[model samples]
Target: MFGIGIPELIVILVIALLIFGPNKLPEIAKSIGKAFADFKKAADDVKSSIEHEITKIEEEGKKTEVDATAPAKGAVEDKEIKK
Candidate 1:
């Protein structure tokens, strides 16, 4: 799935079988599956955390933009009244 196609996957599986033998293949596969699952969960957690931080930053930026423009908005009206 990670860009390795069917033939590459078959080759890898054959090598794993040769190295670990049939008796140990299931156990190894199970362990690999669990590790992959754990990795995916951790990645998702990190992504969510980063997304939450970005949202917080965006909210703060909007507030800053408003705060920055607020004084200028009033300054224009003050000068118009003087004229």
Candidate 2:
């Protein structure tokens, strides 16, 4: 994929084999595959979280604003005594 042809992949694999030795090639390949999979999963999780937050903000915007005259129950009555 990404314009990488079969010959290019073969050359890359051959180089890896030379560097890591045949015995460790499979292990290295497995690790690489796992890393890519984990990266993709993490990216998806971040994307989903961002989308959820955006939806919550949009829903909040859609809600009707509260009327100011409604005295909230817990407000303190601070009537000032004039001297």
Give each model a TM-score: 0.69, 0.74
Output the worst ten-in-a-row residue range by lDDT, candidate 1. 70-79
What is the per-residue lDDT of model 1 for residues 1-83, given as tens digits with 9 covering 90 to 100? 78999999999999999999999999999999999999999999999999999999999999999898776643666667888
The whole-model C-alpha lDDT of candidate 2 against the native structure comes to 0.87
lDDT of each: 0.94, 0.87
* Clashes per model (N, Cα, C within 3 A): 0, 0
Which 10 consecutive positions of candidate 2 have the poorest summed lDDT?
62-71
Question: Tens digit of lDDT per residue, candidate 2, span 1-83?
Answer: 99999999999999999999999999999999999999999999999999999999887766633435556687756663332
